[model samples]
Structures are given as C-alpha cells and as structure tokens.
Target: MLVPTAAGTPAAPAGSPADTAPSVSASTAVAQARSTEVEEQLARDPGRFRVLTGDRPTGALHLGHLLATLDNRVRLQDAGVDVVLVVADYQVITDRDDAGDLPAVVREVVLDYLAAGIDPARSTVFTHSAVPALNQLLLPFLSLVSVAELERNPTVKAEAVDAERRQGRGMSGLLFTYPVHQAADILFCRANLVPVGQDQLPHLETTRTVARRFNQRYAPTTGYFPEPEALLTPSLTVLGDDGAKMSKSRGNALELRASEDETVRFFRRARTDSERHITYEPERRPEVANLLRIGAHLAGTTPGELADAVGAAGAGRLKTVVTEAVVEGLRPLRERRAALAADGPAVVRDVLARGNARANEIADRTLADVRELMGTMYS
Candidate 1:
C-alpha cells in the first residue's frame, strides 16, 4: 500500500469496491487541488519561484546539453523566474581519477553558457566551491539521511557501477554521499523548482525527502525549506555519432563550440545503415534516426516531416541535409562564443564573481536561520 503524506482516512482494502471508490475519488481530488495550488503559486509570481539547475562542469557543453537544459533555462530566465545556475565543480571529482585543469574547464563551460544565450545579468551562475554555507548545510543533511538511504538512491547506485567499470575501483565515500550534497545545493538556495528529466526524478525525490525531513525535525510548525517541485522537461536523448549516448569521454559528442567545419566533418562520418532509401526507424536504424532527430531539433520540425523530405535519398544525402541544418543553426552561437573568447577570461571571471557574491548573501541568510534553529548560533 502507498503511504500517505498527511493524516487522512486510511484507504480501504482492495476487495471492497463500495469502500474504495470514495477513497480513490477523494485522493484524486486532493492531488488535483494540490497541483492547482502549486500552479497558482507559480503563476501569481513567476519571479518568486526560484529555480536551481546546473551541470558538473567536467567537460565542455555539447549539443545534447543544450537541448536537455540550457534552452529551458533561457526560457525560464526570460519568463522572469529567478534562475540559479550552479557550476557543480565539486562533483567533477566523484568518479574521475584526475581533476584535470578544472579552472580552465570551468571557464570553458561558462563561455558555453554565454554562447548558448544564458544572459549573465538575468541568471546567477556561481561555482559550488565558492559557497561555504553549502558545507554547513551538507553536514546536517547527512545526519538526517542514513547510510542505507544513501546506498538505496538509484542514481548513485547506477553511477557507482559505471564509475567502477571506468575506474576499475569501488566508489568513494564522497560519491556515495553525493545525493545528500545535492540536497544541500537545492535547500541552501531555498529553490522551489528544479528542472529535471524523468530519469532524474529519483535524485529530486531525494532532495524533497531531505527538505521534508529537515523541516519536520528542526522547524515543525514553520518549515524552513520548501520541498522543491520537479519541473519536468521533455527528454532529449541525443545519441552520439556511434548511436550511443552523446558523451565527452567517448569523443562522439558534438560540442556546442564546434566549428562549422568540425560539425560538417563529424556528422558526415556519423554511422548509418546500408539502406538505399532514407527512413525514420529508430528501433532498426538508430544511427539514421539519430541524424533525423538532430535535424529536427535544429530545424524545429518533426522527424516524420524530415523523413518525408528526404525520402528515397541515400544516407549521404541525409547526412548532407543534417550537417547543413546543424551547421547553419549553430553559426550564430559560434560567433557569440568566439566573441566571448576574444574578450579573454576576465569577462567570465567577472560574471562568476558577481554571481558568487550575490549567492553568498542569500546562502548566508539561510544558513543563519538554520543555525539559530539548530541552537548552533551563540551571540
């Protein structure tokens, strides 16, 4: 039986239709009402709904990252929502053997964000290591959660397995407890909304659980943290040239900063079946379908329409079409990135510095409140 969050009449056993009907109906009504309430709250003042989203900054941002998150972040910023983009620099060490010039990597990631239209004036972009309050929040959050609970997080488990395979070693204790750190990331900013894909629902649920537990234990009557709601976005699983998930480590990803010539060359070499005619059958022709999906995403059209447009054409023609669309679409972004690069590291540093100062101010207030509640504040 699914446990309820609030005190309510217990759900009847499955056999009794007469008793179960009202309970089911009431449960549905309550769920709908709560959803409506959240919607109203968001609609009333979009700016009041603080959104926290970020990347690990392990590598340069790629096209997959753009569609998966950066685009949505730009939309949210334009809609006047307070956006906090965390550069999760600390997480880069979780599975890797070497940090590898992290400062340079972080700078490149910031430039990619600016190139992809993330306006620094509108969104706060700060590094995770810049904020000391996060550490304080993380310690208490760790106590609230358990070893078993951390071990049970599906995301962490899957990542650990993958890390083990790559590193040929067991996961570190820090990697095991990364979810608790993520919870602190969200709650420290008091973020009310987090944009995530479906697969990330488990991570968000962990964050919600941490928030709820803290509020209940420390400030039962007046909640200190808002249990963040997941703002589900359309999943964009852009495959690499080899028909696997696009990843920097695999060297199959099309970086956001790829030059026009590089974009053309990469897609030209993308694997496609020996079919004489073009078609959109992802199950059987994933490589060709991957090209089609990339074109659709770039051209703002459906894969079916693209298939019809390229009907009876060979894979070479399809590649040509896809490459042109991708290159043309990315031209403006490339120009912007080039301009930002010409300005040097000073601009990126300034943007991050301002963001860090502002974020620290907000985080300090929240940490102060938390300390007062926990009786750690003595003046």
Candidate 2:
C-alpha cells in the first residue's frame, strides 16, 4: 500500500505519486472538475477551443515527451481544435545562454513533431523569437503579476532551483518571470485551452489570473481575453533507465531517434532489482515498475499485466520484452523521421516560416486589440 510522506519529509520517488500524500483540497478538486467540464465541451465542439502548448528546445525528443504532451497534442489536433505549438526557443536562455546547438535542436524538435503526427497543415508550429507581438504582451502581463506572485509560483521556483543546482549559476531575471512569459504565450493567441499536467497548474493559474485582471482593469465588459482552462492530462511519469525522471542530459532517456539496436542496448542496461520474481510494486520496486510501465505503455496494457507476463522470467526477459515493444511501437515514427530528415532542415524551416507568418497575423490583431483597450494605439 502507498503511504503519505510526512511534512518536511523527502519527496516520493519519481513516477510514484500514490506514495505521496494527496492534498485533497477543495480548490484542487474544483480545478479537476473544471478540467473535466472543459474536456467534455471540447469533445462536443472542438472548433470552439484553441489549444496552446509547446516545449523548450533543450534536446532531442524522448519517450517522456511522447506519453506526456506530444500524444495529447496530436489527439487534440485530430479532434479539430485550433492547435498552436510554440517552439519555446527563447525560454532556453532563461537558464543557460547556450545557443551553440539551439538551431539544430529546434530543427530536430520540428522533425519530431512531424514524425509524431502533428500535421503542419492542421496545426500551427512557430518559434518564440518569430512572434514579437506575443512577447510584447509580457510587459503588461508582468505588471499584472507581482514579484511575490512570480516568486511564489511553484513551477518557477522548482525550475530556478533546478537551474542553479545543474548549472551552478543563479536564476536569470527572465527565468524569474518565466510563468508570465508562458501566460503571454497562451493569451497572445487567445487560446482557450491549455494542455497541462498537475505541476503546470500553477503556471496556467497565473495565466488565468492575468486574463482576469486585464479584463477587470481595461476590457471590463468586453472580456477581451479568455481565461484559458487547463486540459489536465492523465499523470503517467515515464522515468529514465536510471530510475529517475527521464532526461536527455542525464543520458538515461530513450530518444525517439534511437535505432533498434540502441534501444535494446539502452534498455538492457536499465537499472532493475535483482529479484528473479518480477512484481509491479512502484513503491518498493520503482525501477522494475518503471520498466513495466514503459512496456505496458507501448504494449497497450497495464503494468501489472506486463509484470504477470514476466513473472519469474527475470529482468533479462522483461527488458527484452520492453525493448522490443519500444522498437515496434516507434518503428513508424523512426521511418517517417528518416524520410523527413532526408529532406534536410529546409522543410522544417519552411514550415516554421509559414507558421510564423500565420502567428504574426494573429498576434498583430491581438496586440491591436490590447492597445485599443489600453488607449495606447496611437498608430
């Protein structure tokens, strides 16, 4: 059975949320209910909602991205929602100033999106740098949020701590206001639905706060900005081979670009318990359970079922099954990516060019509305 950690106690292991105590707060429950309502509304009339979600171009795409946001993005796009994907290239500097491989990483990210079924024709894909009007919303949005509120944001706090620990540098000012920037990303396009996990609720809440404050202050009756709703995703943490959060920098992740042989070798070396009898015990046997979870995700079954299938077969058999499942599951993506990559980065550039053009048109209109609302539209 899962146990809750006491106050001041260490956090539960990654991917084992049930082992941690539940807050069970009324506000949280309300948010969940609202998310459910938005989800149902979206299903009935997807044309009514616009979704804004993206990733920072830190590295190659991994399985973690697949199970988390990428798949959800595709699902939403297929449902006929207006999906706007931002390659958060500018946010990468919030932690480090490394632009050496930024361009390459951005191209790879676009390639990954295409390979994962985010049709360029159906969904808009653009970069942060290309959208100046979007960033302009930052100044006003920043004013809407106080320093205390920004600092209080758990996502910003955790990211700042992570950056300091990993890079041995203090958090950048941009990093401090990262949530506000995200608010801009969502509000600039007037996106009404944002796909987020529990950890990201703080950021989305901040966005909603900005929208509410702006409407109350300037566009009172107009309600110029829609307070975006969170489309909370099913929580399924995909840990790395080292039994921690799957990360590209940690070298424990299985990249979507990994070859079949690489996939096998990587999973073969995954950290697993020595017990010959396999069991799906996330609390006690996190690593084993993590593998089971990955295998089950790819095999379209529950982790318990995968564990039962691998019972007494040992970690070797389990690893083999998971690795093969991954290879088979990712075969189509790899093939499509290979074909897309053969065309070089030009194709991605063209897609971004088109996306940026479309985004600029939308941003210009949004900014015009903002200026008129604030009585600053002299032009």
Candidate 3:
C-alpha cells in the first residue's frame, strides 16, 4: 500500500471510479494527503541514532520489501538514523541460477533506494560484491562456526524448507551459509543497530551470536563485533494483492515501479471477503481487515476509528474508503519516484561507487585485525 506523505500530490487515481471516493465517515480523503509531518517530527528529535539495513537483489522490490528497505528507511533516516543500504548481489547466487543478472540487479536496487528518497549524503549505501574483504571474513568465520550450528539457525531452516518445497530439494551451501555471511555484513562495518520486523529477530540474533563468538575467540577481554542490537520494529506490513504476507515468489506483490493505474487496479482486485459489512476485526475479517489496516496506517488513526466508520458499511463503501486512503498514501511517493528516476542510471552508479569505497574502508580494518591475529601472509 502507498503511504502518501507529500502535499498537493494527487492521491486518488485520476481514473478511479467516481463511486470509490471516501465516504463521510472516513477522513483524509485527499487521496494525496501529506503525512510526512510524523517523520519530520521524528527527524528533528536529537536522540535517534544510526542504522544499517538493506536487501539482497534477488528480484524487484515489491511493496513488502519497500516498507522494510525504503519506507522504514525514509522514516529512520528522517529520524536521524545513519542508514546503509546494502545490495546483497553476492547473496543472490546463494542457490545459483542467477549469477549473470547480479550487476544489473544491483544497479536496479540502488535505483530503488534513490527513488525511495534515501539521500546518499545522509546514509552510506554499498553492495556486497564490492566488498571482497567482507566476503573473505565469511570463510574464516565459517571455520570458527560449525555446520551443526548453521543448521539450527531459524532463517536457514526456513529458507531450506521453503527451497525444498519449491525445488523439491534443500537449498544449497550458499543458502545454508548465508547466516554466517550476514554476520560478517553487520560486524564488518561494526554496525551497532539494525531495524528489523519482529519475525526477522532470529536473523539478527545470528549476527549477535557471531559477534559474541568472535569476541570470545579473538577479543574475549577487549570485545569486538559490537554485539549489534535490534531496533525491534513494533509492527509489520503485509503485501500481495491477496493480503497475505507479501513475497516476490508469491506473485502477489506490488512493485514500486508499478504505475498509478496499476496500483489502483492492484488494490481494487485485492482479496476481500464477501460479507458486505466492512469491519476492522483482523482475525475475523482478513480482507476487510487488510483494508482497515491499510487505512488506519495511512490515516494515522487507530484501526478502531476506521472500524467505527466502516460499521455496517457494505463492501462497496469500504472499498471507497480503503481505495482513497491508499491513493492518498501513495501519491507523494510516486512524485518522489518520478523525480528520482529522472536523475537517470548514472546516479545509482555513483552511489554504488562511493558506497563500495566506504564499505572496503571498513572491511579493511576488520580484515587487518584478523590477519594479524592469525599471523596471515599479509600480517
């Protein structure tokens, strides 16, 4: 769902059916209502700190991924979190069948970050392929870590089972070894904070374990790895037109690149129950529940307020309110994307160049420490 935060931005799709306008019970029907005020407030706060978060460019970022990597990124950046967008191009090859597309995919992800308003100046963004030292850390760390330990990691098991279901076999070594590499990604830069949804806590825990293990093995007295901490996101956003947890493989995801018409069409067709009365019972009314959730999120009002307005309203009335909220929510984002896309592909390249250099700089420090400790050739 588009979260409209820009002012004077057109929210309702121009082609939206006339009847889909917000009803009296619903507020903020501006379709393109400005809501960045909240983020602006957070940005002005002095206490907000830095963050390192990103994605592996396995596919185009759908709405689900955007909320994590882009929307939350914009909010945190505004909240003064020093953000680093990581393009895990190397991780895409974890299970193979995608080695050739990594470069373009990296550029594509970088563009998405830029389009999403991640200011390169406020945040440093980098690609995994560019940081050879970071990747090298994975090898030695893997030796310190054991196969049995890897198997126990939650993300590993989840992906392994998922891969097995889809490919009729378990995911490969890269997929299996991904958790350790992730540990390196966080620890190499000495990142102290990662923003993560609740379900992703386990993934971040692995980073914590690795930091503890490495510090115990090498710097037990002084401590290294920083034992990165989690911001522990309060809520999660769902995707897929079906209102299920959005995923690329599910074919239910809406891409950031989707057009206004596409966005409208996508939401209009989203799965909702046949029971006409629009209510905000998440457990009871998943379809209407999804719409209510989107509306509440965008309107900055509690879901209870939405349910009150929607009380006894049939599906048609509920659709009008939800559609309006969604349209208003996305309009500013569309404008921002249009402006950023005009900057052209070269912009992404420069961000990558600068980010990669910064990453190498950090990775070099860790690599140096480890080499000296192990009495390597360079040391």
Best by lDDT: 2
Off by over 4 Å in 2: 1-24, 159-168
- Report the Cα lDDT for candidate 1: 0.81
Candidate 3, 1-379: lDDT as tens digits: 2221121222232234421323332312221121233234344652344467788787767666654556777877776776777888878777767476676776667776776778888788998888999999988778766787788777788886788678456688888988888888877877766766555665666676666566655664555556555655545567468777778768887777778687778777788887866667777776777667766766778777887898787777776777777667767766776776688778778888888898899899888987775668551
Tell me the lDDT of model 2 at 208: 73
Model 2 Cα lDDT, one tens digit per residue, 1-379 = 1111111223223235422324537546756887888777777888878889999999989999998889899999999999999999999888676766889999999999999999989999999999999999999888887888887888677876787677457778998999899999998998888888777787887887787777767865546787777788977788887778999878889899989998988898889988999999998998998889888888899999999999999999999999988999899999999999999989999999999999999998988889998999786
How well does each candidate superpose onto the true structure, as a TM-score? 0.87, 0.90, 0.81
Best by TM-score: 2
Query: Of the candidates numbered 2 and 3, which has the greater TM-score value?
Result: 2
User: Which of candidates 1 and 3 reaches a greater lDDT?
Assistant: 1
Query: How many Å off is the CA of 63 in candidate 2?
Result: 1.1
Q: Which consecutive 10 residues in model 2 have the weakest lDDT in total? A: 1-10
Q: Which parts of model 1 are misplaced by more than 4 Å?
A: 1-45, 159-168
